[model samples]
Target: MSKSESALALPSRRALFKSRLNNRTLMRQVIARQESRRSRNLSDAAELPPFAVRVLTRMGFGPRRTELAPQSAPNPNQVFSDQFQRSPLLGKDDVAYFESLGRNDDERLERYVDEQLYGNLPDPEWEQRKAAYPASFDTLDEPLSTTYSERECQGFSNYVVPQRQVERAAFARACYSRRQLLELIVDFWHNHFNVFSGGDEDIYVSWAHWDRAVIREHAFGNFHDLVQATAKHPAMLHYLDNYANEAGGFNENYARELFELHTLGAINYLGNTSPLDAPLLAANPYSGLNDPLLDALNISDPARDIQSHYTDNDVYEAAKALTGWRYDDEDIRDENNVCTSGGTGAFFVNEADHDSGGKVILSGGLQNIPADRGALEDGEVAIKLAVYHPGTARYIALKLCQRLIADEPPESVIQAAADTFYANRTEPDQIARTLRTILLSDEFKDPANWGKKIKRPFEYAVSAMRAAQCDYTWRFDDRDTDNFLRTYEGTGQRLYWWRTPDGYADDRAAWMGSTTLVQNWRTVDWLLDENDDSDADRVMRIIDTTLENFPGNPTPRELVAFWCHWILGFTPSGGWVGDVGTYYAHEPTALGRACMQFITQQDFNGEEDSPPFPADQQIPREELRNDDWPNRWHRRLRGMVKLILWSPNFMQR
Candidate 1:
């Protein structure tokens, strides 16, 4: 029997035929592994080292090639905690992009983050960096070369002009940011309060400000502050048509969402109390509540009479309080484009249009807030009320857990995080501390929940690029940038383009459709190709580095195993060494074949076997030339890379 036949260990000897070199051994092995994995079906997730792998994959993007430590499988909790305490660092591509700016080094935000741990600027530095960006960002940061005084830049509500600097920067950071957890949360928050920039020209201007001045600023801060920032931003005002809201009319858009989507969440009608059936409320059976739909949607509030649950009345009341909030530029463009005391990020109030009449809110408990001048204090009071509402804490906490842990997060985990959020209500890092509690919990580290959340489009692309250590280059053409950006859009979760108010969903079913699932992979060709060609050299270099960094020159098993874990975050079942061994030998240098043979544990007795099959099936062996061999083998490597990336194993988080 041939060496290949012996290695497979087939039950019957009938399959042991001639050792012809054109074998589909590797392909067969892949098929076998797929079948084996189906039967195992994550049965191996909780095992020691695999458990470690599952933790990293779930917590952040799967680890980079150099990050795998099979020798010392670290505890998942320690890894989770360690990431939070460290400061954000610059990534390799970030360093490269900054270096290319020769004289602008001091002005780069990349340097600021590296040296100062935050992205604040003296003035010119921030604007210079913005201007240096590709034109795709212009909609967000137009007048890029010009500088804005700190006071002027503060919520300066200009007109609707959408730009994507934040989206572009976000894409780069996710691919290369050292602060992994922060980036992950930033994305979560953005989606939580989505404003479709494509709605109008106004959103372009408003979203850019919101993305930078608001979302990025408050991402790690208090949940209240985040709620406040979004509540008053012109983008949200315009997205929800609150700008047109006046005494004569009302726009329930922003206010309704503020209670239903942003703060209390759709299902959470109870403001700050647990359900009647909750452990804390076990003593109370019929907690005093007077509303039906509110109670029907949310459990009966134990503190019901004390903390009133919301009703349709609350949405309109909040909207009444928010009257006169609109973009200063659009609101009074004829007035030399002047805005409020605050600029773009600010929600300039048109007092003349304000509902100045004093009124009561919720008509219940402390929830009943007093009215104010031109409804000014009303807006502030409305935001404060919603964010501090107990339901807000639970809603935000549960969503955070869902994003960081599982789709169906355990009640214990949700309650624990909610408790932390409520306890540190005013701390700037309240969200940070709350996340720490959930991330460290056993629920997050549990391997059974490893693949619950699938990667979104931007997340998947950036992470894949980072894993491969991909060198991202851009064509000078704006068209190229648009094409590049379209790949992100292809996943149906494009940033700043969610037309509806609720934004992108964390639910797996939203992105995981029959055709949409494959679109993410189909566009990878552009990401991998250099200058848009089919050459595989860039991938080859990355692979070589991955191979060389190991304890020893890895055989095919060692090489493929490392990537399977590094890229897919799980080890392959039934092993893949033998087929890779056959692939390498088809047309390889003596050294390469030797490495493959070693990985496969094949006997290399220095005796020649039959020559490999011809490269083209159409031509007989006699017609083929020796020179064609190199091309065949290179093609093999491409196949291996694609199979690893496109397989079902890599698709799940």
Candidate 2:
């Protein structure tokens, strides 16, 4: 039934020869057949693509960290997150008190509004408030001034801390649980409806809610409603400056992004990975002047006479219909000048500030506005109208399909997801179901797509730590090391705070550069070294358990290739081990032993690019190349680990 069993079934040579004396030719044919079969089996091992091997290792709880995930049948990310979910934030009473203070009971709600605008009103002038909240701090480099180094700036800022924590917890869950699908979902949703953590007041606070409320809530839901919900979110409002928009102060930042960044990006075909050389239009209306239609959408645009489906004037008119909105703050006084206890922390509508008369939208044309519309209700309607546009479905569908399927998804995938979006209408949960259909579809599981995607830094870093079985106790209070993690949050990959409202670049071309490769390699080295520092025994245990049957009796070259595939997800091309293999051939057993030491030496973190092994380790000197093979084997194995760390595969994913 199996190879080992069949081998045992073979008769002894003396008995076999005697029995087969009259059938020598038959015995010869059987021997030849056995030899051929062995060759085929060995070749099969080599045929597995490096990428596939890497993908399996990184995506699944493979041998190295199987304990983290018990080969469970269902979701991986969920199992992982559940394992580490905050144990209800101990001291429930304190948390409850804070939460209760922000609760929206009717009396507290009215009082809260009163306090936000008027309670702290300086007697002489409200001019300071208006000055502090300028109409436009439009340039990318303006408004926010920073003198700290990248690392230092990241340390002090509380922005993006929540997301970093959430992502790490999700990663830990994946590494330590059987639910692989859950990790995939977290990544999918986070990317699908991406939001930057840095921005103005409402957005700054609202981003806290968006991570779980908007993105995670509808992660597995329908794409349409996810877009719509995000559009309504104050974080989106603040980030896109929609709250700044007024009846005459039209800003298309939100509207344009509703199309470009959120739903259907500028590129027409789904998941096309081509670099956009054309002027990059903003995902929100306020991205910049690169777009003619968008430039016209700016509140200050003078071309008021231009006739078009969607124009700056229309955006301005829309903004006017949705003005006077402010966030709910416990310490804040309302416009009427009273201290308040509770209200929703969002853009509030000021009836006086809103120009609620009927207006014309370029795309929808002359829509009648309700006469009694208030800021909150009017803004909600505007967001709804923007999200329900015909183009919105197509835009959202393509993005959802891309996140679930491929960077280059098929037309069918887009169509299917889009159809689901349309059917689900405005329900976020329904949209998640549509996404689940795409994630669990035949197309998603195809072999051609196996490892087709590259690991984002979030995936790469967390997976590497998991592979090494590193234990991390990340705490928000631990500012020193917390700073390092925070620096990497959404800043690396050039997605730094205040960089662009359009969000991070999400394709291969955007990520695969020499700088990124170097950074990745350095990061890998740091993590490996950290793993060694944290728990050397645990690291060793993971290696032993993970590579139990690696390459079966592999040659030196095969061993090198195997390590690459197991860790980095790619086999080194032939040149990588050509010389090493030649040396290894002289004493296969000895060279094989060297691999273990090589893996251990990866503990060195100081200079990531420098080779970790001693020069003597790479080549066997005559004195060390003795027939007493065990010692020589140890030396050779030491070299293998260094080479493994330095291999190209480690640099990529």
Candidate 3:
């Protein structure tokens, strides 16, 4: 067998099932190791790192190496050049680009924020890379039924081709795109207005449209526009059972989540109370003004009073208003039993199924829908009322802050972002302005707040690949890529696979568990491994840490230092650098011995370490001075890279 084949082999089904028996013991060991790392980071917290490092890792999927200018440049005495030479792993071009924006950290941060928010930076490389994956982008305009039939005719038994293609493209963008802020915001919105792309055949087949048209288009656009688009999309309609909602048989699934998760959030949820009992607020100026519905209701000064909090009665009324909103499919019909729309995959209101009776919503408010209004008007008004609520602004702002800053961000920043969101409700760049408020706030640049957040599984995986300069092809049929994704699922944060509408938890407590930690470590190994059974030249290697790229023969200590600086971006504490370097000097063959030593010696509940290095068989560093050392230690060096990625320093933002 080839080296890749041996390294990438999978266990049998029975063996995999039997492995579950040991999960309890494995969980304990992972917990202990995490505690040790946490303590060490707290102890070593003194001086703050550079702002560039923080921005690259937290805002984007970490940094990649950049081409350096010649030492004989016009301005060779520039201080950045000296810093770049000292830390060769740092992306010199990236840092220089940020530095050119302003003279200091705060100024540079503001410039960078505006550039990203306005999308002033063009990434031709990402566009060119994305162009290669036509299959991922071309099916967005196709109907779900047509796409499903075509896939079946093409010998695909499953109807998930579009979803898989989208997943591949998303991964590629996260790893390669220079529009880093846009990509991150897109991810945040996808999680916020999440739909299970793999749940149903229609959703699976039309997943491309949901991603491209609904989410990406409105990622930095108005929040109200995004919510309305999500409410009408077929993926969300099917996922939340809104397609079946009608006049006689109302489905409250979409309505409940719209209020609880999407719009006003649970913070404004006053359960099982009369709508009239909720606090009264001033009416939204944009809604209920000169409306035919409210006019027909014969309510004087209908826009005078509005309810602050929503009750169960309000949800029921919202469901009534939202009835008959569905995509253009074969089943849509009018009261005359004639087909109104079909096979278009566009949203349409079925008048036959719509509830047009007179109803009062937000009860003290004059936002009432009179009987016999137009088909789509009621739903539009209802959505406007929810989107314009004060609670919606605060809820969405808090979520954005939680994603970009800390889990529990400072109230000052949240209020500032919320004000921006509310004030710019009618602006095209509402979301962009809100993000600017958060990113440029003093709370964001505070030294004490740095590294307070932990990287999620998606962030960790993409950042590791990016830091190592992984050559990702994003081809759906590649064996190694397939293996990497399957292993990534174990981390429990698979993209678009979140079961509930609330989405994946963003706080540290949700992801700090032992299962998540161990699974993330396993994903690191998968990334470092070579493609199984393929020739070195034929295979698209994920990572290449072999010394063949080095200019000259280097000692074990130097090798350790290079990777540590490359992956962690800053020097780590807790004797990690010295311990790993010493272990490499003593045993060159067992490159990850020191890492395993740290894991085990820290009282990690006696878990058995892998690729076992014998304690008695130590090879001195001088023994590896031959010309063939690079080829001999290529795989072992990858093991060391895995160790660095698994370290706690890499986990922090």
Candidate 4:
């Protein structure tokens, strides 16, 4: 088989994680979780009915409570496909408020979702709010430095504050955007063309420039446009240390990742070794000879033994090709080291910093542009060559298919998607067209692949908030937004803060650790006001408000059932509704206490107190065991939301 075929055949990060679930430690942890919730609450082993769950979980931020409702459409696929035929822009979901005009109207669901797909949706309230907010969506046309303060940092307050504003808007879009797929695509491109936000204190000034102008602007536009835009974007220029890449010395950081992570993928990169490095490897260097990633991660077979499509010399040549690409505002000394500001600048090439050399790329194509003319032409040519290569199509297609379908997606689907990509190489909607093929394919909608993908921390947090209809406020003035981001501190995905060029891994194994379990459970505060620490009122408001949004006035059992239907997108296990309904029959506080202990205080092992008996059987709430039954029932309802939120089933979507 071919190299691409060999790579695709390899077991993915999910398969690796699945294999490890059988390990003694993981097995014991699962068992302990089961034992703790011994009131017959099955762990992830709980069966969910087919067709109830939607593939939108992988496509967007998962389905909301309303989305989980029985669709009025007789054929759901037709309604879903009608929306995709149009183009998509960014969503205008306010992170602080769940309300969007017509979002709650059952009849306008497809119409609303369709309009957002093309960015044709009218969000009058959002427009008004944008006019009032200082975050300047106008950065799409200019540099972020110019939009914010061009002045130097004073304790980084100005930089961070505006950056936080952009971040809040981004989070809001993820949580409430009608254009879920569009936001998801933008996120994919952002990570693909990632520039760490925390690297240089000054970088925050250029954050929106990169996000708005480069990534988001060209997200659905074209493959060539996106690559070229990111390669020249100031945030990326500085992040990869390409700004310092001069004629005498070259940094292969950006060029290497451009091939390894962005376009060709690590499987095709072949490392920094070339025929010239044969002498170095044969002589034995001072450091570890074996690949650290291969060993430490324990990847076997084909993935461990990948064929190199390009070598280190090619990366060096690529860096030389990209030389002199720098932003304005850089200090320049014309002669005698006299420094003067170039002022706030756009992308431009400096001939003095460029390496005037003929180079051979991976395809053995000669790039011999004369130094006297076309200084920036070779870099552009090189990017075009890389993007159009057959490997790039396959690699990029695999990722698109992986993120949309299962981690170990079927080879048939990948080949089909890659075909679409190559066929639409010059089209404006190249990536979108490719995604459309994969998304609408039988592979994506197949029952086998429904929950195959795992939810990253960002997806989890946003989906939970979306389902709960969270009235979150990330305003710096209130400090809630700071706390929101902090909650993601050690979690799976921290938006825009990754320092490395590889960006965040799509691999679920990279995230599913023991400690992350508790953290994931603790983050259910978005669902209910339990963590609000208020004496009263918030719980009742949350419970009452959430129930009111649903169809009928549901009792405790029916409420639990509706939530199970909404949150899990399926019915609960056999005894679940009865357990919740019977226990929360009158005073819901008992249900609250049960779920909190099951979630908040639970850990990896059964090293704590014995499991509590069924509330209906032992210590009924009528006695008000330790607290007033009537007073605390609202608190118990909060606990119910938490229980559903923290379930392993919810973790998958």
Candidate 5:
């Protein structure tokens, strides 16, 4: 039979079921290994592997497989050299620039950080791949008014399509983008200023605009600009109930989150304390009540100083400042009944609905907004005050440090980053400057800080795909893509689907649950499956195990080493190589024998057979000369790869 025909030979349903059962057993073993590793990591002396391994896994996804040439007889010695030459998936110029960074770790990291921060590098391959998505998705780039009228309210039939397109595009970018640091920063900003796309129909239709205009545009720009853009965006307006905020009725949803979650953080929240009684810094002590209303209230505290902490009064006043800020909706109308709001889905102040009242914000009467300030000036001042506050700077810096360094980063790094953030609050590249300070800090490069964080589900899935060199066609209509997304959702990190304003948790404790781990294993299993038995070309294959990819009859030890370098970015010590090689070589363990029977379609009895080969021993060349060896080896290799992906090493950042 032809090689292709042999590869496509169908297995019986019973056989498939048994294979799945065996996979479950293998998964359990991997989970046990993970638990042991976790215990070790908690120890004071736990050390990470290497610099490249840690940084690549943390800063980007993981080490990607470089495209290899088809060889008649692949030499293992040449594989390491060729892998770093170029990546077929990334732009040639981009790969060249990356390689040109430096020879050593410090030089490479310094150059790479600057390049990513400035975003001067071009990724033609990524751009071309993104352009291949359906042109209908281009409408997402239009203004919210256009999207709302033409797509959400009028012409387009499906409101969910825009959100789906955004989600798919995000996954594609995470998996393939050459500008990995920019992508990582964009993700950080998204979660920081999160607005759930699934919660409101208006948000669903304008989700693309929100992602592009608010998050991606200002990802590395000024934090002040990002916050202002988010405050005015239709998605945020609707998601936070700011759209419903009006004169007589105040909605504190957006305003409260503006303080607690967005800017100052809940760490700065001081509940129900009268502004007059709140404490102030010794450097900036209270002078006198600035607003007449505060004087009229007869609340007096000479010890009270310039607002060091926000009170419940702050949330109330901030809500009043944002009272007139809302998007133009279809329901809005004018005195002449001419749809004066334009149904544009853009931000506009409704003069009639504005509170138009003087407001005292923060304790000790700092930032007093005068009565009847028109054209949304009140809201603008409020946003500026909140975003520029010392607490805001510290809060943002702490979060950034947590994301880039460790879960609980050193106080010295946080203070340094916060100082950078506050110093350049007005610069266009303020965020970039702050990030540079953090990335180049001693804490970031310290080996003790490495492997202290766990990969969230989204990171795990994307890193796996990148490492495996999966041929992912990220089209909405492709069944494999759809199935992949569906299975990924089971791990509980569905993109843009976090219902809460806090977004997904970044702490390790939140994701180390038993259910999440098992679901992740199952997801990897699905990724490596040959979904179509009759058509080998239609399979959802992650890696190709033929001679072209792994030329010659390599011993099981060599095969395990190659994949470990490819996936884990390092070869692990201990008897891991021997144990996995034993499984691939079909040695005499119970699971190994079952896997062998499944792949070779032949049973072996330990009682009747002679002594089994040692785990480190290589499989004989004669046994590899069978007509169906390529097909059988492909099946066996898939199992071994799955185990590697499921390993504790792969689970770390």
Candidate 6:
């Protein structure tokens, strides 16, 4: 048979086994030789390759990858010779603009909160304040203690304060950051203990509570403690309607998501294994060996399968358990003629609303659990029961490792991390130790894994701004108008603009389409020249300041080529340059000389002194002209930049 046909043939089972054995034998020999060499009391020290370092950084948190070519390494000032930091991309002035906006946001949030607490405008210029920070919708003649309006105070109560603080805390940690790993942990925990900002009044306070009590306190702590805090937090209680859980009404939203999303992945028949196969069938979905007994718990269905089984009843039970715990409304008044009911911030468990009969919780923790602690004190016992489960440890460890390493982390790595979690059950902060072990492991910084994650819209936008040094702000007076747009953060045009609860999709295929490609090209145009209102010399200086060690090649032809290289990071091959040149070859280099020939025929922008097209070239005047000369010329430049941005090289760290 021909070599190709032989290669395509499937190997026999014996041949496959032989191949695996050979690979294992080779690896073992390499390790044994390395160990023997090290026995002379010498350390086997090897610096990570440059590409590996870049990959490691991207794996943790996406950053712009510099040129990985060894000869293109950056100099002492920390810039590459071939690259110019200056771009029609972001510039130095943009950083100042964004930072200024950040400061203004801080001031606005402070004033808005102060005004809400004291029952009066915090500033004497309150009307001007109304003008400056107009509410999205008009308030009633007087505002109610509880409001669902898109008003600034309530909006502040919802999206702004907690987000700003979380963002600021995260940004601060990013700036001059020492604890690199903590930032990754915060991201993991934030997604893990997600709170829908638009949930309710209590969520305003509870949002902050989850961040402070659950995510932040134990972000690097033990998985057990993190889950416990999340289960008990007032924000989670209200967000998931857990506060409303009671005997007659069980809201299993918390319970269901806690398992399917937060803890153990749902059990199902493997795609390869037939469901009818008894040997392949695992444990019952409803009950892991450790599920709690609900006889004393008084659930809607006492014998209900509250285990891993995802029945319609499970969601109901999950939602019901979260009932009755609600926010203290500032407007609520008691019969004694006083507004005494709503204390506002704390998690209040009302006895009248609680299901007091005993409930057994079935969890994987059955081996060591102290049994259902009998009729519990409202939410406290339930919270503890949810948090202290063994499944929480494994679930949390898996998530942390996934974020730091890969989504499908090695079973050994997860087990090691989970072991750390189990060992430190009492001190919930042990989760961080497990994470550190994972991140610092050889598997995490692997070359094959570099630049593997598709950047989410927000990460894409932020990383682009940081990379290009773009200096723009979304700080217009009517801020809520911009929040939706801000979701697209990298490329100016908003991304998918998703309205669903799933947040944004996390795959590259979602962004790789013709429309997005056109949008990306448009952004490159805007970054390069459309936003070029500032002086050209000033713009160049901003480029010099931001891009390090540019000008890798000093020749005239190479200078233009090098600019493309720094901006695009890859050298254009002959075929590529020929493609761009094919469009422009018909045109003369000089406008003055060319305009002499075609000045009367060319149209110009309305400005009286606006220049006309080059005389020697035929410019398409508003006919769908992708193929015509001038448009093609524009496309050549814009295309190179766009290709750079869209190319896999630009997609890396």
Candidate achieving higher TM-score, 1 or 6: 1
Per-model TM-score versus the true fold: 0.68, 0.56, 0.79, 0.73, 0.81, 0.54
Deviation in angstroms for 255 in model 5? 0.5
> CA lDDT of each candidate?
0.53, 0.42, 0.66, 0.56, 0.67, 0.39
lDDT of 5 by residue, 131-217 (tens): 776553565577767666655643234556677777887777877777788878888888988888898778888888888888989
- Worst lDDT window (10 residues) for model 6? 39-48
Report each candidate's C-alpha RMSD, comma-separated, in the order given: 11.2, 18.9, 8.5, 12.5, 8.4, 17.4
C-alpha-based local distance difference test score of model 4:
0.56
Check candidate 4 and list the clashing pairs.
87-117, 87-118, 88-117, 474-481, 592-636
| lDDT order of candidates, top first | 5, 3, 4, 1, 2, 6
Q: In lDDT terms, how accurate is model 2?
A: 0.42
Q: Which lDDT tens digits does candidate 6 get at residues 1-653?
A: 42212211222324323332222222233234323332221101211223323432443333322322333322334322212222222122222211222134333223222222222212222233234433321221222222222322343544344433333333323321223345445655665566665465455434444555567567665555566566666666666666666667566667666655565434311223221231311332222223244223333232332233223332333344444665444444458765433344544556566554433344221211132232234344344444444555576667666555554667877877777765565553466456555655556656554444444434443444334433333222324224424433444223212233233434444554434433443343344333233433211122332224332312112222333334432342331122222322222211111112121122222333333333223333221112243223322222223333333334433
> Candidate 3, residues 1-653: lDDT per residue as tens digits?
32212221223323322343222233345345465454233213222445766777767777664332232222334444322223343234454455445457886688677767774665666677667766545565565556644542232334577788778777888877777888888898888887887787668766877888889889889887899899988889889988899998899999999999998899998898777678876664345334453444443254456788888988888898889988855444579975443344668889899898866677563456777775577777677778877889999999988888787899999999999998888788999999988998988888667766878999988888777766656656667668778999999998899988888889876777767878887787676665522335312232233333345555445556566655555443432234432442232222133433322121122333332233233333332322133223334445556666665556676
lDDT of 4 at 173: 70
Give the per-residue lDDT of model 1 (tens digit) for 43-86.
23222235434444454555544343323322333322212223
Candidate 5 Cα errors over 4 Å, as ranges: 1-21, 32-47, 68-100, 154-157, 282-305, 331-342, 530-546, 572-631
Off by over 4 Å in 4: 1-44, 49-52, 65-119, 123-145, 148-155, 271-308, 330-342, 365-373, 530-541, 546-555, 570-631
* Candidate 6: segments with Cα more than 4 A from true spot: 1-56, 63-180, 201-214, 267-323, 332-343, 363-390, 471-530, 535-642
Return the top candidate by TM-score.
5
User: Which pairs of residues collide in candidate 3?
Assistant: none
